[model samples]
Target chain A: MTAATADRVVAEARVCVAAVLDPELPMITIEDLGILRDVQVHDGRVQVTITPTYAGCPAMDAIRADIEEAVHRALPDHGVDVLTVLAPAWSTDDLTDAGRTKLAEAGIAPPGVSRLAGAGTSTTSRAAVALELSIRCPQCGSPDTRELSRFGSTACKALWVCRACSEPFDSFKNH
Target chain B: MRSTCEAVATEAEYAVALADDALVASQRLVEWVARAPQIEEDVAIGNIALDLLGQARLLYQYAGSLTDPPRTEDDLAYFRDERAFRNVCLVERENGDFAVTMVRLLVLAAYQRELYDRLARSVDPTLAAIAAKAVKEVAYHRDHARQWVLRLGDGTPESHRRTQTALEAEWPWVSELFDGGWLAPALVERGVAVAPASLEEPVLAFLREVLDEATLAEPDPRPAVTAGREGRHTEALGHLLTELQHLARSHPGASW
Candidate 1:
């Protein structure tokens, strides 16, 4: 196939792979979560790269399988390969606005801005500075929420309880 | 790759050593899943264990790529013998109590934070990337340990005593972490790895501050004679590996 045809095929494959929902958080697609790193088609083969939100996220295998299945359904004749890249690491800052909205709608507080954004922001300094931002309860929209635990149902979230609605919720932790 | 075959071998060994530390520590932490003092702690410790396990998998994958035949992460993690494992004795030591686990985590996380910070600037792109990601994760791990250490050391008489004892027991193993064996110096010179000894000053300084704030005394600096970098692990590692590798060995290439 010509270069233009290959590019179109890769673009179509990207759409298919991007629509795959995150197994752990069914509300958001992998693309919305910023885990779908890249999609390329070369020599009639499709290559999709993804990065895990957490190192040992068990959802990765399912996501990989889902990506393969999606690409195979879209381009049946093309071989599909999923690659996991660890470099430049994944940050919650990569999450799309749509992803944050979807998470909020699903009663999960979206992640706050990543404190590790700038260069030379040492861990010591970051630890010394406490996060004081108010997180509104997703269920009740109450700003009066207390952290029950720094870790919650998943590695990426923290457990919080709202005083207004007295409902327990998960807040996506900002790495 | 510009790296010579010998250099690749050395880098692979270094990666294995780092991976082993994370893998062993993750296994120990996994024991706390349902056994922690509080339900919150169970999730907390499990999250930390998963983070460490993730780091181990990434390092193992990188190491495998360096091999001639190119082993997978599973091959390095499950197939290797105890004698071939290169994690430090600190991580391999049995988890005695909650206080012991917290103290061990405090020291290891502090050391890893320093190690990874420098490693983020490695000449090797892959190692640099892994370290860059790890630095952030370990920073949180260190903070978690520090918070627990402060709370346990200053909360009650029993907690204080237990935390202190745990610190002392784990103190001897700290020296082995800084003992740079054969591959370290060469890797350091090549801008691929940090000199373990150079991390001692900063790691201790940070620990001392944390201990002071916790109202805990620092144990006397008596380094262990056994060097884990040279593959001289305590008896505990073999047992830990047996439990870790058993399922994988029992059903080779098994996956859910």
Candidate 2:
């Protein structure tokens, strides 16, 4: 394939793969969740790299299947491979602005800036977590929220109750 | 001495030991789902179990890769008999009660968090990468365990009593965690693994602070029943493995 053709194919593959929605967080795409790392094309073969938001996120299997299907459909002639990597780690900071807005719209609070604002280091100990201080309720836009469970329905989220609205919702856990 | 555990000499064996720790702990933790005192707790414990299971799979996969011809994670997890397991005895101990479970989780998480934090910089790239990912996940686990430990230890009179008892019961297994002789000395020298012995001081310091805050006294040190590193285990591991491996063993080539 020509360099330009290869580039076009790669770009197209990324678009289709990026549009694939996460299994659990259906409101956001895998790209929005920062789990989709890179998509590379070589000799009409596509390799898509991903990282799990939570190590044992059951959604990983579903997301892998979805990525394969999406890439196959978008680039019919190419073979697609999905690989999960565990380097550099997935932090809540990887969530995009678009993802944050989508999460809020879907009534799930976006994670606080604990990882981002902690001098850009992810200490993550109990005292260093600072996860609770900034969780504004998605329903009422109130900062008065209380954590119900450190864990939620999905691996990456925590269950929280909004004191202002009394509506329980999931908040992304800042890794 | 190192004579008993000398067989666990290579990186593969080291990885297997690590995987066994996670696999066994996951099995124990998952028992609490639906049995925990509250729905939130069920979710919390189950989530913790899932993380441990994930870590186990990663370690197993890495260990398999180092073999002459790679084995699958399932191959190691299912095929291994009780004598092949390298997990510390603490994990295989029954999840006696809420307090016992919390105490076990607290001690294990404290050790894992510190271990992973240092292991993240390991000379072995694959292990290092896995450790870097795990360090974050384990920090939350440690915090979760700490929160419960403090609550139970300092709560009501009964809670304090049970929590204290649980801590004392679990303390004997604590010494086994710091025995690094199971691994080849070269592994630590090469920066591929940390000496488990070196972890004792930091781990104890953290535990002491938490125990003090919770108004729980450290029990007198009991004689160490250490041999899990040498694949020697209490009767509990056999029963646990039967439950863990039966389905996979029966279904030979099954997958969803």
- The TM-score of predicted model 2 comes to 0.96
Candidate 1, residues B191-210, lDDT tens digits: the string is 99888888898888889889
Taken in order, the candidates have interface RMSDs of 2.7, 3.4
Clashes of each: 0, 0
Each prediction's DockQ?
Answer: 0.54, 0.53
Question: Over the stretch A1-175, how does candidate 2's per-residue lDDT look in tens digits?
Answer: 7889889999999999999999898999989988889999987799999998877778888999999999989989999999989887888888999998999999998986755222124333246344567689898899888999999997788999989889999998887
Tens digit of per-residue lDDT, candidate 2, span B1-256: 5445546569998999999999999998998899999999999998999999999999999999999888899999999999889999999998787999988988898888778878888999999989887767877888888899899999999999999999888998999999876788889999999899988987888889889989999999994667998889999999999999999999999996
Report the lDDT of model 2 for residue A161.
Answer: 96
Residue B142 CA displacement from its true place in model 2, Å:
1.0
Interface RMSD for model 2 amounts to 3.4
- What candidate 2 gets wrong by more than 4 Å, as runs, is A116-130, B1-6
